[model samples]
Target: MTPYPRWTLRTEHTGYTVRLSPDGPWAELDAWGPHGAEHGPSALDWSHRTHFITPADAAPAEYLPYGIRPFTGAELIAAGPDGERGSWWEFDGAQETGTGLRLAFTDGLLGLRTVLCYETVPGTDIVLRWTEFTASRELRLERLDSAAVTVPVTAGARLTYLTGQWSQEFQRTQLHLTRGTFTMGSIQGVPGHAYAPWLAVQDTTGEDAPAYGVALEWSGNWHITAEAEPGGAVRVRAGRVPHEGAVRLAPGERLTTPRLACAFSADGLDGLSRVWHRYERRLSGERLHRPRKVLYNSWEATGFGVEAAGQLELARAAAGIGAELFVVDDGWFTGRADDTGGLGDWHPDPAAFPDGFDRFVADVRALGLDFGLWVEPEAVSPGSRLHTEHPDWVYRVDGRPARLVRHQLLLDLGRTDVQDFVIATLDRLLDTYAIDYLKWDMNRPPTERGRPSAGPADLDAEHVAGYLRVLDHLRAAHPGVTVEGCAGGGGRVEHATIARTDVVWPSDNTAPLDRLAIQHGFLHAHAPHVMSSWVTDAPGVFDPRPRSLAFRFVNAMCGVLGIGADLRAWTPAQRAEAAGWIARYKEVRDVVHLGEARLLGTPADPTCGVQYDADGRTVVAALSTGRLDGAPLVPGRPARLRLRALDPAARYRDTASGTTYSGAHLLHYGLPFAWSADHDADLVVLTRE
Candidate 1:
C-alpha cells in the first residue's frame, strides 16, 4: 500500500507550522505567539473534559487548553482558572466511518472545530453532505458526507484571514499558516459577532485559483464547491455542530462541526460530472419531475375583488401571452373579499369563484395552459374554517395568539395531524383540479410557541421534518406539477429550500431598479432559473422612471419572464414590445436559463457589466450606471472589457448593429460601447459563417 502522508505542526511567531509526514495517518498542529517559542501542543482530554475533540488528546492531561472544547450532553465542559463545568462529553470518531479528517481547535478566546469526510457510493459518483448551523446554545448534530475523490496538491498553500471589506488591503491578520498543498483562504473576525468569516484554501496552477463558490447560511453553516466549468463541481458541505461558539467561555470553551473538503484535478472533473449525472438520474428515477418555467402572480393585477369571470379573463390573457402555467395568486379562495379573510380554509370561495375551482382549471386548460393555485399552507386566518375546526393547530402563547407578523397564526406543522391534514387537502385539490403548479407561501416566521410539540427536540426536528414531508408528499402525488417557494418573497432563498422547490419569487418588490440589485445578490449562489418574475409596476410603481418597457423586459429576461402588471390596461405599443421581447426570450431561453453567468464589473464599479454565454452564443450587457463625461470621442471609447466562458475559436456577429468581431478581439479588447446616465445596452453574439 502506498503510504499516505500525515501533517506535523510547529508553533511559531508568524503562525502555526504544519509539515506532512511521508508515512502514517497522524497529523500534528503547533501554535506560537508573537515571538518564536513553543506555545504548546494541541491537546484533547476526554476524561476530564466534558466534550469530544477530534484528533483526540495524546496524554490524558488534567488541563486541556486551546483546541476543541468538550460538550457534556447539552452543556459545554469548561476547565480553566475556573473549575469543573458541565458533564457527559465524549469524542467518538468510530461513530461514523468514511474518508477524510477532523480537526478541533480552541484558543482560550475562541473555539473552531471541523470534521472533513468523503464517501463514494455505487450508483452516485460523489455525494458531499453537511449540516447547517442553527441558533442553539447546545451542540445540535447534523452530518454532511460526500462521495468524491480527494485531490492531492504538490505545492504549498497559505490561509489568510482579513477583516473589514473584502476589497480593503488589511484589517487584521488572524492566521497565516503554511501547510502542504492546502491552506485556509478567507477568515474574518468581528469583535462581537458570534460567527466569524473563514475559508479553506487550496492551490491552483495559475494566479487565479479556480473559483471555489461558497453558500453560507445566516446561522453560520456554509458549503463550498470547486467550480469545474463545463463539467459540474465538487461540493463540500458541513455535517455536525463543531464550529458553534459560546458567548463567554472563562478561559476555556470548545465547539466542533463535521466538515468535508476535497481536491481533484481536471481529470476528476469528468468524474464529478458523472456524480451529478447519477444524482439527477436517481432524482428522475424517483419520479421527481423538473419544474417548468411558471407564470405567477400577485393580487395587484386581478385585485382583491376578483370574481370568477375576472380570474378566467386573467387566465386566458396569461395563456395568450405564451404562459405555460397560470396561478391564481390570492382572493380566489375565501368567503372574505380581501386579505382579511379565509386563509386556512383550502376551499375555493363560492362568492368569488361561483363556478368552482374545477371549472376554473378547465377554463385555464382549455386555453392550453397549466393551472396553478396559491396557498400560505403555514398560516391560518382567525376567521377561517380550518382555524375554527382545529384551533390547536395555531401556535399560541399563554392562551393568547402569538403575533409575529399580521393577522395570521402559524400552523403547528410539528403535529402529525397537521401534516396529514395539509397533505390530504393538497392531494384532494390536485385530484379535483388539473393543477400543474403550486405557489407555496409562508408569510410569517416561526414565533411565540415555546414548544409546538411535547419536547424541545421534537419541536425542532418536526419544524424541519414538516417542510420535508410536505415537499415529499407533493412530489410523490403530483409528479408532473412544479412547486414555487415564496416566503414573503425571497426571504426563504436557501440551498435546502431550493432543493425542494423549483422557483423562488426573487422579491415581491420587483420594481426594475430594485431588481437589478436584488437579482445580483440572488445570483451570487443561486441559479437564474430559480429567480422568477418580469416587468412589474406600470406607470412605475416605486420610482417614476418612465424608462423604456424594453429595459424592464430585458432586465427581467435574465430570469424566468412573467408580467406582474395588468395586461388588460397595457397600451398597444407596450403589448407589442412585450410580445417581441417574450418572443426573443423564447428563441434563446435555454441558453440564458442554463448558461454560465459572469459579472464583468463590480457592483460598485462605475461601468456595470455582465455577460451570459452558453453553447456557442454569448450576450454581453453593459450599463453606464455612473456619470460619463460626454459622448465617446471615436463613436465608442476603449472599454476594458473582460469576457468569460466563451469559445475562443468560434467566429461571431453582433445582432444589434450587424458588426462582426473575432472571439480573440472580443475577449482582449471587449466590445467598445458607451452609455449615458443609467442607460443599459446588450449585444448578442451569434455563430457566424
Candidate 2:
C-alpha cells in the first residue's frame, strides 16, 4: 500500500516485514512481531538519526557490506587482491519463493554478488535466514555474517542466553544493555560449553513481556554480537566458522553462511520457548512421532573397564527392569583401557569380547534388548594406531605443539581422506554388528586448528561441513539406527546437530538435583524429545544434597528417560521399585515427548516441576527441593501446583488416585501434594473427563 516495495513473510501466528529503503538501494526491516504488527505503527522507525553516521549505519538495513555501514557493524566484509576493502553494491533484483524471499545485490567493480535469504519455517513461528556470496573474481572475506536482526527498543535490550562449564552446562544467564556491544560465542572449533548458540532479547525484563529470540544452526566456532545504538535500536549479528584471520573465496566459488533462526513471542520467554520447540519439531520431521526408547548406558556402571562378562551382567539387570536398549559404553573397542588409548580404532576388543562381537551383540538381543555402542570417531589418542599411521590427518599448526585436553587430539574431518576413513569405519561397524543405537561423542575441542596440506583454508567451516556429511550418510545409509549426539555433555547442541541426531545428552553429571537444574535450562531452548536424560549414581559435586532413588527416577523421567546407574548393585527391593517407575514412565512418555511442555517454578524454588499436555492427557513431575525439617506443614494444608494451558471448562480425573475435579478448581486451586522426607517427588497423570 505504501510507495516502498515491501515483502511480508508470515508464519502461523507471526509476521516479518521488510521494505526496500526509500533513500537507498538496500533493504531495511519495517516490522516484526505477532500477527498484525505491520498494520500498527512501525516499532523500528528511528525518528532521530545521529549526525555524521552513514544512512546504512542508522537505518535498520537487512544486510550490508563495509562501505555502506562503515561506522556501525556489517554483515559482510571483503577485500580485493590489492587489499582494498568494502563494497559499493547496488540492488540487483529480488525473487519471491513459496516460503519467503531472496534479495540480491551486486558490486560490479568488485565482481561480487550477494544474496540475502529468508524462509519461514513451515508450521512454526520461526524464520530461517542466511546469506550467500559468489565472486566473479577472488576475494578475501574478513567477516561474512549470516544475518543482522534489528529489535525495537525504548530504553535498552534485556538479553537472556545460556552458558556454563563442562559438567554444568545450559545455565540460564541474563544481561541488561543500555549501550555498547555485548558478544558471546565459541572459538574452540566446536560450539563449546562456554555459550550456547542462542539469544533472547526483550525491551524490558518481565515474565509476560513481548520477547524476540535467535538461534544459529551452526555446530562450528561462531559469534553473536548485539549492539545498542543511540538511535534507540538494537541490531544483532550472528555468524559461524569464526577464525583468527580472513578466509579466501576463489573465483566461481560460492560461500553460504549457516542458517539463523529468528522467532518472536508476545507472551514473554515462555512463549518464545514454545516457538523454539515447535521449530525443533519441524526439524525432527517424522521422528517427532516416534517413541524414544528407555535405554541403559554402562558408562557410570563400568567406566573404562568394559568386558563381555561384565556387560552381559549389566544387560541382564537392565533388561530385567524393562529397558528397551542396552548400550555398552567406552572400552568396548581394542586398546581402550583408559582415556589415553583406543580412539580412532573402531574394531571390537578381543580381550573385552572373548566371544566374537557378533556373539556379544546377539547375546544382548537375546535378553530382549537392542544393542548399542559408544564411539568417538573424531578423536585420536597419542597411543592410537590411526594417529601413528596418519599423523597428518589430525589438526595442527604445522610447527606449533598440539595440546591435548583429554589425552586426545582431534581429527581434521575437513580432509576427504579422513572423512572417508571415518565413514568406512562407521559403515563397517554398523554392517558387522547388530547395533540399533549409536552414541557419537566428541571428547575435546581442536587445539592448534590448522590444515597444512590445504593452506589458508577455512578449517572450521570445512570440519562442520564434513561432520554434517557423515551424519547425513548415517541418516540415509543406516536409516533404522538411532544416533545420540554428545560432546562431553552438550558442547555441540544447536539446530544443525539437533536436526540430524535423534537425541542429545544434556550432561554427564546425572546426579538428580544438578541434572534437574541443567535440564530446566535445556528445555527452555530445546524440546524434550531430543533431551536424553539419565539416572546415574554419581554424587553431585555441585549440590551434594542426598536424594532418594524415587527422586532420581522422577527427575530423569522429565525427558527421554535412560538409566546409567549400576543396576547390579541395586537390591531386590530397589530393582522392583525401579521396574515400577520404568513402567510408569512408559505409560506417559508419549505425552512427555510429543506434547506441549510447560516448566513450572524454577529449580531455585522450594518445589518445582515440568508439566506436559497432549491428547486430553496431562502429566506433571513435581519435586520438592526444600529442607525436610525446615517447614512443618499445618494439618490439611497440602502443597498445590497451578497448571497452565488447560481447558478450564472441562473436568479432569487423576488416573493414580481416581479423583475427579473441575478444571476451574484445578487451575485456580492447583493440584495438591503431600511431601515427606522419604517422598520428595511425585509423578501425576490425569485424563480429561
Candidate 3:
C-alpha cells in the first residue's frame, strides 16, 4: 500500500496532487486542470503518474537516496551548532487543514525542528509555502531558504521573467530553459527596480499552454534562482539573500522565512496573473474596497515652491475637478527649499507657513478635501541642523565620508534612537493636525549601508524592520491616516511593503502613452487598486511621448486614479473635461478596484488593452499606441471592444448606448470603435440586464 495516499488540492479550476512513500518521502506531485477524485490518493487516479517519470525510473524499487530516484528540492534545510548538517531528517508526521497541509521534520541529535507549510485558496491556483525553524538549544543557522521546490515540467519548458532599470521597470524576458542555474537578486539594501522578485516556467506549446510562476513576498534584499537539470527537471529557490551574517537563533527561539507563492495556470501567463491577483487580494489591501479618493498632489504643481496661499489655490482647482484628497508634497518643512537640505527636521518651515499646519489644514478641509503630506523619515540632509546636532544618526562607516544621493544620507533606522525619533515625529504630526494621508518617499538606495554605531548586525534586515516598526506605531496610534509608498517612483514595490501601505506610487513617469506599458506590466503581480497612477500634464519623463488629456485620464484611471496636473494652468474646457472624467470614474470605481482583471493582450503587443470584470459587471479600456492600423478597424468608427465574464444566457446593455445584446454576440463580435484620435483610446462599461 502507498504510505502516503494522493493528497489532492484543487482551486476553482486547477488541481495539485502529491503522494509519499513511508521510507522515502512526499516527493512526486502533479499540477493539472480541474478534476474530481475519491477521498484517498489510492482511490483516485494514479494511472497517469508514470507518464512524467522515465519508463525505467517509473518502476518502484527499494527506497534509497540515489540519483536514480530523481533529484527533488528539499522542502526544509537547517544546521545546528553540533555540526549536524544535511545527513538525517526523520519524518515525524503530517496533518491537513482547511486550506492545505503541514509536515514535520526533526533532527533528533541536534534538537533542531522544521515545520513545512502549504496553503491554498478556494479560487486561486497559487500554492503557498513557507517554513519555520526552532531549536531546543542555541543553533547557528547558516542557511534557511524560503522556497526550494522541484516542479515536474514538459521536456522543453521556457523561462519567462521580469528585469529592467529605473524609469523602465518590468521588461519581460522569455528564454528557453538550459541545463544550468539561472539566478537573479538584489543586495542593494532594498528591492531595486532593476529586477523584480518574481519568475515563471511555461510549456513552449504556445501562449495558451500550461504555465507556472513564483513570487517572493519580501521588500528588502531578495534573490530568485532557476536550476534546470539535464534530465528536464527544474528546481526553483527564492528568498531573502543570505550573502552576509548567519541568522543566529537562541534556545527556545524561532525564525520564520518569507512566504513563497507558486501558482499554476493551464490558460498560460494571463491565468497566472489572475491567480496572483486573487492571492494579493486575499493577503493585502484591507481598505481596498473602500472608495479610493481622487487626490491632487502639490509636487508637480509647486515643487519646492510650496506655500500656504499657492496650495490653497491649487486645492480649489483640485476640488474643482472633484479631488477628494489635497496633498501638500515637499517644501513644507524646515529649510527645505529643495532636495539639498532640511530632511530630518520634521517641523513646519516658519517662513513658508507663519502659522503651522493649522490654518492651511482648515482651509483645505473647508474645501471638502482630506489633507496629506510628504515625508522621508529615514533620511537626513547633511546641510541641516539635525545632522549638525546628531551626526551619528546617519549610516556611515568609521572615519569615512557618508555617500550621498540627492545630497541626503539615510538615517540608520536600526538604531533605537532613530526608531523612536520617527515614531515621535509621526505621532506629533498626526496628533497635531487633521492630516488624513501620507506620501512616504525614499529617494535613494542605501550607500554606506553599515551602521557603525550599532554593533555587528545585518543592517538591511534591521533597517526594514525598524521602518515597519515606525509605520506600525503610527498605525496603532492613528488608524485614520492612509499611506502611499514611493521609493523614487516604485523602486521599493514588493509584497512585504505593499502589505503595510495603502497604495504604491508606481512611477514618476506619468506620460499616458508610456504608462500603458508600465501599468500593463504592474498588473501581472499586484492588484490594480494598490497601484496609484496619476494623470499628468508633463510629458513621459522616459519616453517623452506627447498625448491627449483624455488619453492621459483613461490611462491613469486604470488604477487608483489621481490627478497630478497643474490644475491652475489648465484652460476652462480642459477642467470641464477633466471634471467629467472624474465623475465618470467615480461611477465605476468599485468595478475597477474590486474586480477580476485580465490583459486582453500584453503591453508589448501593438493592440494591447486591459479588462476588469466583477459580478456580471465589466469595463474594458482599449489602448491604441499608434492607430490600430492594418487590422480590420473602420476609420472614424469606435474600435470593436469585447467583454469577458458575462453569463452566456443573459442579455447585456451598454450604458452609453442603452442598446441591449446577447452575451454571445458581444463575445463573438464586439463593440464598435470610438477612438478620439491617434494615440487616444476608449473605455466601455457594460453590465448584464
Candidate 4:
C-alpha cells in the first residue's frame, strides 16, 4: 500500500498542499487574486454541495468520518508575502455560523482565521469549542488565542446534516441545534436524552437517518473557542455566558465556524494533554482532589469467600507490606456468598462471620490500615430482597425483563425513590462502618427505555442529577472517605464522571504490557489518580519467575498502585521485592502524580518511553519485550538519550541503580546500559541530590 502524502502548504491555488503534524491536519488552498465569486439567488442554493465519501477500508477502521465543505462563493481578497486573505465561503450550522474567514501563512502551513457572527434565539450559548483530532487520523485544527472571543447568545436555531459513513447508505444524519447550551436531547428513534452536545446517528438506511440530531437548548449560554496548537492538541474551550440574540443567520446563508481535526501515532493521554496545555492555559488548575498513597486490594487472593478471619489476615498482610489502605471486595455484603448473590443487599452478611460488622471494622483498623469496601450500588440480583420488594425499581421496557449479568439487574437511577434509597444506604454505611474509602461500581448499561409515571424530563434530570446527588451526599455524609468510580472498570471514566469522584479504575485487564497502552490512552486528559492494578494475567500469568511481577509493577507505577492479587500466597522473596518497589514508588509518587509530565519517547521503540516530572526528576523504563529470548549473556551499551523536561542546572542521582550523573550529561549524552540476554531491565528513577 502506498503511504498517504504528508500535507504541506503550496503557493499555487490549483495545487493542493496538506500538512499533517501534531498541531494539525491542516490544508492550504491558495488561488491567485482577482478570482471570480460564485453567487446564487437564494442562500439555500449556495449552501448545497456534494458530500465526500469516507473511505470504507480505513485502517484503525475506528477513525472514519473525513470530509471537507467549500463555501458558495469566492472573492478577490488580497495577496502579499504573508499569504492571500479572502472570504471563500460561510456556514451557519447548528451552533454559531461563520461570517467569513481570513487566511495567512508563515513558511507554507496555512493559518485559517474564522469569524463567527450569528445570533442564538431564545436560549444561550454555554459551551463551544472546535474539536478536530482522532487517535488515528492525520488532521489538525489549532485555536489562535489572539483572534478568539466568547460572545453571548439569545436565540434558538437548528442545524441538521448527514454525517458518519452510514449517513449516505442509511440516509441517516446527525442533527445539532443552537437554541441554548448545546445538548443532545434524543436520537431519531431512541427514547432517551443526552446531556452532552454530540450524538451518534445509528440508522443504516432510511428517511429517519436525518432525524438523528443534537440540540443547543440548555438553560444557559456558554463561552466557546477552538484553537490549534503547534503540537497535536486541538484546544476547545466552552466558558459560561449570559443569554443574548443579536445576530442571526438566515436560511441559505452560511455562517463560518471554527473547527479542526488532526491525526497522530500512538501517544498516550499525557502526550495529548501536553499538546493542549502548550496552547491553552485554562486547564492548568490544580486537581480538585488529591490521591492517596499505595494500596492493596483483596480480590484475587480471597475472592468473595473472605470472612472476618481472612479479612483480618489480609489487613495484617497489607500493613506489613506498608500498604496504606486495604480493600475487602465482593463477598462481604449481606447474603452475598459469591458473585451471583446478594448484589443489591448492602448490609453485611451475618453468615460470612459470627462477629458483628463493627467488630470486623475494628479489626481492620487495629491492623493500622485504612479500610475500604466495594459496592455495586446500582445493581441488584433478582433474588435480592430489594428486587423482591421493589420490582418497579429496575429499568424495563413495557413487558420485557432486563436480562441478568452476573445474575443482577441495574437499578433505575432515574427514579427518585431509587436515588433516595442509595443516598440513605450510603449515608448509613459511612456513619456506621468507619470506612475511609468506597469503590462505586456500576456494572450495566441502559438496557431498556421507560418514562417515569411523572414525566420524561424527570427521567432525564434524574439520570445525571442522581449521580451528582450521590456524590454530594457522599461528600456531605462521609467527608473522610474517598469514592473511586468504577463501571465494571473503565466504562464510566470520563471528564464528567471525574468531576464527581476521586480516582477512576483505568481497566480490569491489567496485564503489564496491556496497561502501558491502556494507561497511555486514559492519561491524555485525565488525572494520574486513574487507578491501575498489579495483578497476574495470562501470556505471562503462569511464569514461575518475577518477570510477570516486574512487568506488573512497572505498569502499576504509571498510575495509582493497587495490588489485585493475594499477597498471602506470594513467596517471601516476591513479597520483599514488592515492598521494596512500593517504597521506591512512594519516594517519587508526588512528583510524577502531581507534576507536569512530558513523554520523552514513544513505546514503539525499544529504547524509548521516558517520562519526566514537573521538578525535572525522570523515570525511564525501557524493555525489550520482543528481544528477550534464549541467548548469550552479552550486554549492549545503552543509547544516549535527550531529556525533554529537565532542570538544566540540577544535579541528579539514579534511585534504583545508585548511579550519579549531571543534568547536562544526562540530557546530552543520555544513559549508558546494555540489555541482558535474559531480558534484564531497569526502572531508573532520577532525583536531585
Candidate 5:
C-alpha cells in the first residue's frame, strides 16, 4: 500500500482506498468479510479509472480528460453566460476530514466550484458521496450528479433493482448489465413507486458476494443509472433528476445534490444491506426504548362503513387480541365514503359519529390502546367542499384540464395558503382529539404540477420542501404524535421521508405471500424497524393467495406488526391463536426492530429465512413458499438454519426446548426448525449465557 497521496478509509470489516493518479483519481476496495481484508484489491490502476472526465479539447496546461474516461455521465456539467462548448476543470486539491475526504475541483473559466465528498461511519461500510456546486458568477448547469463511481467488475455482471405500481411496490428482477446505459428514474414530482432509488451490481461469474450498491436520499424526483462500458468497466451514477427538469444558476448561488450512499460487501447482498441498516439506525436514533406497539387498523375490517358503534366493536376485538395501537383508517372524514370524494376535509364526519370525534376517541382510548387516524392532506377530490371553495388551490396550468389520479387533484402545496390550510387542519385535530398516531398518506402522484398562482415556479421542488415542513411543524407542535408514511405504498420511503416519519406502509397488497418479495426489496435500503407490514385476510383486496393465520402473523412479524384483518369474521379458535401470536411478538419485538438482519436466501427461493441477533438474544424466522421445489418434503421439520453476529464463545439455550448449544455449533453447524409445503413458518428464539 502507498503512503502519501493515497488513503484508505476503513470500518472494522471493509475499507475504501482512493489515490490521486496522473489521469485524475481512482478508488479501490476491500470487501472481504469483517475479519478478512487482505484478500481484496489494494489499489486500482488509473488507466481504468472512473473520475470526472474533462473536455476532449482542453488546453495543454489544463487538466486533460483521461483517455479512458466516459464520454457522458460526468459528475459536473455547465454552460457559461457566453455559451461555452465544453468544461475544463483544474484539480484544486483534496483534504482529509475526520469522517471522510473532500476533493475540490474548479472550472475557473466558468466560475463554477465543485466539491466531491466521501464519508464512512465506524461500523458501516456505507461510503456516502455527494457533490456541492457554487457559482461565482451567473452560469447554467445542465447536469450535476451527486455520485458517479467507476468500479471494475467481472464481465457479465447482473444488475438487480426494485420496481412496481400503486398497489404493488418493490418487485424484484435481475438481468445481465450489457454495454449500454440502464437508467431508472421518475420525473413525476414525487419519487414514484415505479422504481426504487437503489441498485445492486453483482458479478454473475461468481456468487452474489462482493457486490456493489448505490442509493440516493432525496424524496423528490431522483434516478439511478448503471452503465456497462465497452471495456468491461461498470459505472454507476445516482442523484436528483435535475432541477425543475433543469437548474439555472445565478451569481453566488449554490446547490448541493442529495447524498448518495454506497456500500460494498464480500459476504453477499445481506452483508451489503446490513451496513445500510446500521447507518440508518445511526441516522434515526434507537427505537423508542421499547418495542413497536402491536397496531390494529380499521381498514379491511370496516372500510367506508365506519361508525362509532361499529368501530367500538372492532376496537374491543383488537384490544382483546392484545393490540396496543388502534388506528381508524380512511372514511371517518367529511364526505368520504370512497376514493372519489372528501380528501382535503380533515375533520370527522358528524353524521358518522354523533358523539363528535371526542367521545369516539375517548371510548377507543378506554380500551387501553393509542388511537390513530388516516389523512391524505396533499390531495383534494373535485367533489369535496375544499375543492369547490378554492378552485385555484389545486395544481394546474392556466387553461389546461386538471389531471386527476385516484379521483383526486394534486394540492399546490407550493403555495403558502395551501400549506397553511393543511397545517391548521391537522393542528386543530391534534389539539381536539386524544390521538397518538397519524397515518399520513398521499394516494396519488403529482400531475400537472404547474401552479397557476405562481405561474412558472418550480412546484416540483417547492412541493417536496413544503411536505417536509408540514411534517416537521406537526411534530414540533405535538411531539407525542407518531406518523406512518404511505404514498399509495412505498413511493415515499426515501431517506428524506424516513428521517422524519416513524414508520412506512410498504404496500397495499398485504397478501402474506406477495409481501415476502416486497419486504425483501424494501429492507435493502431501509431498516426493518420502520417497515409497517400488516397481516390482512386471505384473498386480499388484490391477491387471492391463501395462508394460515399462524403463517400470516409470523410473516407480518418480520417488521413492525399491524393487523388489518376482519377479526369479527374469525372463529373463536382463530381469535385465541391471534392473541397468542401477539403475545409472542411482544416478547421478542425489540429483536425484530433493532437487531441486525441476515436474510438467508433470495426472494425467488422456496426456503428462505431471516435471522436477527442483538445482545445475548437471537431470533430466526424460516418461511416456506408452499411449493416443495423438488426438495425432500419434510412437513413440520425445519432444515438447518445458520446464524450470524453472535459471540462465538458464548453458550446459548433455546427457551422452548431447554437445549443448550455453543455459539460455534449454533452458527457453523446450525439449528433445526420445521416448515410445511403450505407456507408453514416457525420462529426459533434463543438466549445466550
Candidate 6:
C-alpha cells in the first residue's frame, strides 16, 4: 500500500506488518501493535547515519542467515558437507496461505531454501512465526531459531522473564538492557525449571506503554536471547533444542522450527498477559468450556503408604467435601514402596490393593468421584524389572555409569522401542481401568544423553518429538481422559505441553504463602484454568509462617482447586469448613476459570487479590499477606481494591454480604476489606443486578 513490497496480518485486536526493504530483497518488520498501526511511517526504518555495522546487521530482518547478519545473531546457521557455515540467500518468492503468510529465500550457491512463516491466532492478538529450511545437499545446522523478532524502541529496552529453581519456579525477573545481550535458557532435556520459554520486552521510558512478548512452543531444551542493537532496537531470537550440537539435514529434507508466538499490547505488561491467556484459551480449543473439577490427590496425604482401605477412606472424605475427582499419586505400582524402586512397572502393587486395582478404582468411583493415577513413564529405577530386562533402554554413554536422581535413571525416550514400551504401558493401564484422569510426571533430567547407535543424531529433538507423539496419541486415543502434566512440579509447562494436558502442577511446595507468590507470578503469563493448585497440609518449605486452612483453600481456589491434605486427620469442624469452601469454589469457578483476570496488587502489598469478570459476574479472592499488628500507611484507612473489566453503569450485589454498589463506584473507589489474624483471606462473589 505504501509503494514498498509489504504485507499486513491482522488478528482480532492487533496488526503485524512486514515489508521488503525498497532498496534490497530482505524483509523486515514495519509495524506491530493495535489495528491501524501500519498507517504511519515505519518505526523500524534504519535510514539515519548508522554505526560501523553492516547494513544487514543494522536492518530489522525478519529472518536472516549467518552471512547476511554477520555481526549480530542470525536466526539460521548451517554448514554444508564441505564445512562452509554461511548462507547467502536472495528473496525467491512469497505466498499467502490459508492459515497465514510465507516468504521464501533461496541461496543458489549452496542450493538451500529458507521460508519464514507467519500465522495469527484468529481471536487473539498473537502472531505465530517460524522458519523452514531445505537444502539440496546435506547441511549441518548449529542454530535454526523459530523466528527473529525485532521491537523498535526509542532509547532502551527492559526485559521481563520467568526464572527459578525447582520448587521456586516462575519467579518473575526483570533486566534493563541499554546495550549488549541478555540470554536465558535450559540445556536440560526438557524445558527445565531454570527458565520458561517466554520473554517480554518493554521500552524503558514509560509505565503505561506498548509492550511486546514472545513465547516458544517447545518442550525440549531452548534459549531466548535479547540483544539491544546499536540503533535503539531490541531483537529477540528463540529456538528449540539448544546445546545439542549440529542437527543434520539430509538432501531434500525439510526442517521446520517450533512456532514462536509473538504478541503486542498498548496496555502494558498486564494487557500483554491477557493476550497470552486468550491465545492459550484458543489453544485449549473446546476443552476450555469444560469445568475444571475440584480434585483430591492422595500424594501428600498417603505418600508411599498408599493402600486400598486408606484410599477408599480418603475418597469418602473427599466426596463429602465436594471433590469431583480423586487421584492416587505415586507408590501404588508394584514394588514401589518408596522413591528408590518400582518405576517403569505399570502394574498395581498387590500388597497395597489386595482385591485388585480395578476394585480399588471402582470403590473410589462409587464415592461419586472420577478416578486418576500418577505415572512417571520416562524414568526407570535401577532395581526394577523393566530396567534389569533392558539396561540399554536408559540413557548412558556406552561404558560410563549412569547418574541417578531421586534414585531413578532417565529412560531413552528418543528411541522408538522405548516410546513404544511407554505407549503400551499407558495403553494397558487405561484399557484395564476406568482412569478419568492421568497425572504424568517426569522427576529428573537426562544425565549421559548419548545414543551410540544413531550416529550424529539430535538426541534432544528426537526425545521432544517422541514426547509430543505420545501426548498426541493419548489425546486422539483417549479423548475422555484428563491429563495433568508435572515434572517434579512445573518443569514441562511450556505451550507444547500445556496444549495437550488439561492442567499443570505449578509446584511441589503447596504451602499457602509460598504457593500464593508462585501462583501470582504464574498468572502473569498462563491462564487460570490450566493452573492446578492444591490445598495441602505440608508446611512452607521457604516461609514457615503458619496460615489458616481458610487461607490455603482460598489461595488454591484461585485456580483449578485440588485438595492434597490427609482428610482423615481433620476434625469434624475442620471438615465442615472445607466443605463450605469447596461448595463456594464450585459456584464461582466458571468465572474464575474463564474470565478476564486482573491482578489487583502484588504479593508484597499489605493486601493482594485476583479479580475475574465473566458472564455478568465477578469473583475476587483477596488475601492479606502482611502482619496483622501493622497499621495502614494512613491510619484508619481501610484497604480498598479496584476491579477491572466491569460495566460502569451496572449495579452489582455481593452474594456473601448482600451489599450493592454501582460499577463506577467499585471501579473508582474499590471494594473495602477488613483484615484480621484469623481471617486473612476472603472469596467475594458479585452478581450484576
Question: Which regions of candidate 6 deviate over 4 angstroms?
Answer: 1-3, 629-635
Model 2 agreement with the true structure over 1-689: per-residue lDDT tens digits: 78978899999999999999876778999999888888876878876456888778888888999998899899888999989999989998899988989999999999899999999988899899999999999999999999999998888889989989988999888888899999999888888888999999998656677999999999899999999987788899999855756779899999899999999998888888888888888898888887899999998889999999999999999999999999989999889999988898889999888888899899999999999999999999888889999998998887799898899999999899989999999999999889999999998888788878666788888899899999999999998899999999999999999999999998888988888889999988999899999888888879989888999999999989999999989999999999999999999999998888888888888788899999999999999887654446444456778898888899999999999888888789889877787899999999999
lDDT of 4 by residue, 46-108 (tens): 111224421121111101111221221111121222333322222212221232222322212
For each candidate, C-alpha RMSD in Å? 10.9, 1.4, 4.3, 15.7, 4.0, 1.6
- Using all chains and alpha carbons, the TM-scores for the candidates as numbered come to 0.68, 0.98, 0.89, 0.62, 0.90, 0.98
Instruction: Summarize candidate 5's per-residue lDDT along 421-455 as a digit string, tens digits.
Output: 99999999998899899999887777676765553
Runs in model 2 lying further than 4 Å from the true structure = 628-636
Order by lDDT, highest first: 2, 6, 5, 3, 1, 4
Winner on TM-score between 1 and 2 is: 2
Off by over 4 Å in 1: 1-291, 294-298, 399-401, 538-546, 606-609, 621-624, 627-629, 632-641, 647-649, 655-657, 674-679, 683-685
Q: Write the per-residue lDDT of candidate 6 for residues 1-689, one digit (tens) a residue.
A: 36867889998888899988764567899988888988988788777455776788888888888988778888888888899888988888889966599999998888789999999888899999999989898888888999988998887898989888888898888888989999988888877888888899999887557889999999888999999987789999999854467788999999888999999999888888888889889888888888999999998888999999999999999999999999999999998998999998889999889999999999999889999999999999999999999998988888787788999999888899999999999999999999999999999898788876767777888888889889999999998899999998888888999899999998898988889888988888899999999998989888778888999999999999999999999999999999999999999998988999888888888789999989889999998888764455546666788887788999999998899989998899988887777888999999999
TM-score of model number 4: 0.62
Residue 633, candidate 1: C-alpha displacement in angstroms? 11
Better of 1 and 4 by lDDT: 1
Better of 1 and 4 by TM-score: 1
Winner of 3 and 6 under lDDT? 6
Q: Judge candidate 3 at residue 501 and give its lDDT.
A: 79
For 114-205, candidate 3 gives per-residue lDDT tens digits of 77667886666777777777788866655567755555456666887776777767667778775677889888777787777888787666
Kindly provide the TM-score of model 1 when superposed on the true structure, using C-alpha atoms: 0.68
Whole-model lDDT per candidate:
0.49, 0.90, 0.74, 0.48, 0.76, 0.89
Worst 10 residues of 2 by lDDT: 628-637
